[model samples]
Target: MRFSVHSVSLWLCAIPFLSLVGAQQYVLHHLFDHTNFFDEFSFFSEPDPTRGVQRYVSAFEANAVDLAGFANDAVFLGVDYTTPGPWRRSVRVTSNTAYDSGLFIADIAHMPTSSCGVWPAFWMFGPQWPYDGEIDIIEGVNTQDKNKVTLHTGPGCSITNEGTVASTTLKETNCNAGDAYLGCTQATASNDNYGDGFNDIGGGVYAIQWTDEHISVWFFPRGRIPDNVESDSPDPSAWGPALARFNGGEECHLPDHFKKQSLVFNIALCGEWAGRVWGDNAECSALAPTCDEWVADNPDAFAEAYWLINSVRIFQAHEA
Candidate 1:
């Protein structure tokens, strides 16, 4: 069904366990949507009729993008904040897919994304959770103090309760109390790199590097992050001490699951994760008085809490 609109292409490399040598060979599921530049579309309460995607997304910029603090030299994703959303205003895909890779990097300058029912996830997953897999590169609950970066895999899948990774001191001996995955561990700066620590630090760059031996992640502030990471699998030494170091060391049996998948960037409003933060609407306290305000304002302004993106570039580990 050609809607007479052009489609964009975004890519992510997927594989079960990838080495740096095989990372660059991956490509995107769809073609790059060049016409869908940051300025071309309008923010909407619904999906764009011309965008070509099956669902409607409040494209970035329509929300609220205040680039004052980050008057940086580079023009990332074209905006600074993110598009407000009940669902994802994804430039990549709406539904969601999973992937495995030697390396995956999400360079985001997230706003203080602490809103009730607002789950801003920059993560990845496999087809059927647990059995397939899920990697939460960046995820948190109601508050921003404690952040959680975990890997969920089993006969099916499971998730860890929220905790802070800013300290990068997470020392878990295993995954979900030994449900399915062999084991997992987290190592990061305790106060300034993991969880809200990363987001609070102006939301710079978060990279997850995976291999058959283990899965690890690192966070670098805007200027601190290097350029090579985007195109290559970085050595763990660069970012803290490998945020999460899962045991089993390749024996845990995480099969090949990473495949070419679409990138999903969403600012989900008041859903599962966000709802949990505020119980029965009572948790909407002063810290986030705008909780409901943003919700109410979403379709109205159709572009309030809009998170501007500068640019999203996906690089694959070149297979040997």
Candidate 2:
């Protein structure tokens, strides 16, 4: 279902009247493509916040090692697959722009495949950690077959997936970032929405609509993308049921929790989440004695651990 990057327009003209609510027009605000991805995103060379056994490199280092660049006219972010060491080299980037509310659309041609010790995510978070809220749009650990959309807030915030697809299961209701930070989570049912299955189908588009009232996420697999989306005018109301929807009524005011968020993409190895649950997964555990040990030794096994992003577009809603 995935079309070549050439077929999709890199520049999306602002659509003045794509409505999500009465008189609210969604207009194109930002576009991230191969031509400007490297410039717009800052390479994070800091120590892994998740304590993953992966070294995030600078833009210069990433480019020198072929860990981050452009491929097939798409933005490529990859990991070190040939070097055997305690920590594998990888790339993590965060957008320079931060947004409070908008519709985000990511057209991806490929993503890191499911593998033991590998954790890949495309998420957004505010500057002040849980206090400002975090949104996990596409995330999973280890060999997970499905994607999990989660929200993390400081306290006094809980959400319900009232309008999500039937196959999506709400795992937690409490979004309070307690000591463990087990945020509210929704598990998707489709295998094709994540990991190896996702890559096999030529990847897809992941859309997120965030507003004061609620936040919703949708996945349009390859050829199944709505005509409106391809045409630069997205109407979530006409996109049918979302894959995951977090309702923020009086119970949980979204604006109070989620604030200006920066988009992030990264791949980590043997991280807290993936490493902690390594023993529970029979397939992953059999590969080595421990997650870190396995990730350190098996360099070739992660050949497919990379992201091929066609483009990312942001649309902001304005009163018509």
Candidate 3:
């Protein structure tokens, strides 16, 4: 979905104490490591919904061109660096299984860094557009050094950023998709949480905890990952404050708006976001007249535009 930024008043509230009933004991439900990632996730060889100037290639096409495969014991999803065409070749993959409330974790060694025409995202969405809901765990466009987390849903869904870290900024509260799908967004304060800065630290782990009451996201650099996260028994309660936290209370109903989400990862080039803001980015606009033109002509500039994922793990609460 297309997103727009607007000036909004900042909202900050105190974090509420969690009761025992709010805590959940989770068990690993699904694991997508390098050995099984290709088998479990399906390549989406369709037109970009965001209108990017990229051709999503099929699994066979990707493998044949070395755009999707294994490298350094991690699953590598990359864009074409040698071909110059109207549309650049890229990859987008979605998990076959849909999930409900759970803890999602992704361990990555590398990801596409900031570039003139690149837009990369790690997100989730339901079957039905807008009405079912969408969550952006990691997303940004050209020259964005920080990560932006957002939520898109149908009418009647507004959220508060009550449990997020103090430095995070909430750009909006209304998540309704009707208003041009702008979605409520929270901008992170750390440069090390995304793009070139993230890769320089050996791209760390991104964890999301989705519950009935709220959704929280956390980022841990290579050396700072929690012990429980490394051991496979994640405890969100002990993780301290989240980087971005969206709370559902009187303003919104969490379960009613979000359900059956499928995980997705993709890198789009010269899309709605990157293209719309091209001129505003002095560094990128100086390279070429337009975003699409730059992406089509400068193939080698995207050599660092790829994803090297170690694993994706999903954990669900054990049934009583």
lDDT of each: 0.43, 0.87, 0.87
Sort the candidates on lDDT, descending order: 2, 3, 1
Model 2 residue 147 lDDT score: 98
Q: What's the TM-score of every candidate structure?
A: 0.57, 0.93, 0.92
TM-score of 1: 0.57
User: Which run of 10 residues does model 1 get worst, by summed lDDT?
Assistant: 1-10
Judged by whole-model lDDT over C-alpha atoms, candidate 1 comes out at: 0.43
lDDT of 2 at 121: 96
Q: What tens digits encode model 1's per-residue C-alpha lDDT throughout 169-194?
A: 55554454466343244544444543
If ranked by TM-score, best first, what sequence of candidates would result? 2, 3, 1
Which candidate gets the maximum lDDT versus the true structure?
A: 2
Model 1, position 232: C-alpha lDDT score: 38
Using TM-score as the yardstick, the better of models 1 and 2 is 2
Q: Give the per-residue lDDT of model 2 (tens digit) for 199-306.
A: 989999999999898899999999888888765667788888889999997778999999989999999888789999999999999999899999899898888889
Model 2: residues with Cα > 4 Å off, grouped in runs? 1-22
The C-alpha stretches of model 3 lying farther than 4 A from their native spots are: 1-23, 177-180
Per TM-score, the best of the predicted structures is 2
